[model samples]
Target: MQFSANLGFLWKELSLPDAIRAAKAAGFHAVECHFPYDTPAAEVKAALEETGLKMLGLNTIPGDVAGGEFGLCALPGREVDARAAIDQAVAYAAEIGAGAIHVMAGKAKGVEAQKMFVSKLRYACKQAAPHGITILIEPLNTYDVPGYFMTTSDHAEQIIELVDEPNIKLMFDCYHMQLMQGDLSHAIERLLPKIGHIQFASVPDRGAPDHGEVNYAHIFKVIEGLGYKAPVGAEYKPTGSTEETLDWLKDYL
Candidate 1:
């Protein structure tokens, strides 16, 4: 039940080096990013080295470079695009020494799209395996990502099972699952073995722990009780200053 601050959004206010410094100063042992490719791998590595922070995770395929939307992996008819995206991710991960990569499922069309998506994932996993990196498939909530593929942990679990590789596992985001479904504890208990990574945000508002309905202390307790030692990603928006918002988590730690 270690904590990690997601540097994707909040860290934007600070330079990468300072962001890692701030996260470490704030009592976090590790940090994560959404798309570190936007920054150079050397800079990211340097920052991690300077701040004594572990690179917990980051996205393997972060969609288009220009559009800022639309992922390549889950697109219905884009195997080439998907492979290129995965290759870029593998290179980046190797360069920065990241542990896992969250493989986002792009927009879903129908049955054909899903089949293609699964095929692409299998390929990505094979490509990433040799790099000593694990591929994590996440399920986004439909409300936030309508028609987007991989909206359920059950679906993500099935995909991981189908991939049948030790390096491929589910990135179970508590916020998304709580929104898409309601049973947080049950889902975690059932899927803990298959989950290689975990993320969190307060439900209903996607804000810091205390600002939303989900009781993070209880959740942390459950996670700890289950003996899951992986870092729990703090992927939420701060309602106030990031420092102020994290007061609620101090007790749990």
Candidate 2:
């Protein structure tokens, strides 16, 4: 199975350009990031070209980190801000040749919130379509982000169904799904069509996959059996150094 070092986590110690180089050195065919806005698009593009690695995806900026706002797309009366956020990500993705964008739906509730999320996604999908970039919405466990709007694979599936946009898809993170709902094999079977991207780490403590409660070896087979060709993201916090903890993945690299 192909793997990706989620630069947001694996290479936090390096600069964005250096992180891309590190991922390539670590034997990753591609990479994804949380937020790459701080680094200029030109610089990021140059690094990818030099390393000959694909930047598979990136997340839209979470709104106002200092103010505790996780995302704006689903916030009431934040329509303008949310669309502007989408526009920025779309521009960056286009410039850097990224394949997808993760559209975050932060702290939201009720029917109105869902409606707003759908509206924002509709706009995102439209803007991203011409560039051939997929728009993804992940189900983050509330345990990690207390009020994150999308918190279950079912919830994301439901929202995607409601939006009914071809470009909009699920960013299914196994760690979050295992925490919120543990039936991963079955979940993968049922949601395969909607899954645009997948990520994993150890469950419970969110550490290296090798020490986790989840058996990633079996999970890797499961993913392959399901015909998922995209690189699986290693989105975990290291117990020690990022490179040292990767002994578990040495063979794959």
Candidate 3:
């Protein structure tokens, strides 16, 4: 039951390279991030090499964040922007030796959005295939990201099927799925085949896993029993300093 620190939430105060070192020092087996575009890939690669930590994955740039755009891939008339973001993410992931890229399907709905999402994902997969990088699509809970295009595991599965790309898979995030719908044990079993990566955070408040309604210990057992060998992503927000909230690590370690 190895763990990957999600630097996007774990070490907000440090640079990405420093965060990678911090994750290593904290004993995380690997590291991941939400966005690492601002940092030079060489520096990130150097840090990963120095720490000997695999970069599990990273997300595409959220389009127009200040204007409230969570993603662009599903938005109508944004094909150019969507594709550009995909290219950028894939290129960065390739340079940093990341295993996957989460192509965000921003706020949208209807058949057109689905069509757009599928098209963009197919494009993303094509670009990433050459680099052996997997494309991940996560179903974000609407409570935290209202109006998000992908909000249910079923919906994400449908999109994955539609894309029909072997390299594309679901980012089965436990926190969002539990918020949208409970039944974690069954969900993991049912979706295991399509899951490329799994992430966990305490439910209800999106904090450290120790206080969550979800019993991650049991969940981890279920996942391991199901033959998942990838390091599970620890993508929770710490309630205090990142180190202070690491008490939960003792249980998992």
Best by TM-score: 3
Please, what are the lDDT tens digits per residue for candidate 1 over residues 183-209?
Answer: 888889999989888888888989887
Using all chains and alpha carbons, the TM-scores for the candidates as numbered come to 0.94, 0.98, 0.99
lDDT, model 2, position 84? 93
Stretches > 4 Å off in candidate 1: 64-68
Tell me how candidate 3 scores on lDDT: 0.94
Which residue segments of model 3 deviate by more than 4 Å? Answer: none
How far in Å is the alpha carbon of 75 misplaced in model 1?
A: 1.1
Tens-digit per-residue lDDT, 66-180, candidate 2: 8888888998899999999999999999999999999888788888889999999999999999999999999888888988888988788889998898999898899999999
Prediction-by-prediction clash tally: 0, 0, 0
Model 3 TM-score? 0.99
lDDT of each residue in 132-233, candidate 3, tens digit only: 999999999988899999999999989998999999999999999999989999999999999999999999999988886999889999999998999999
Q: List the RMSD of every prediction in angstroms.
A: 1.8, 0.9, 0.7
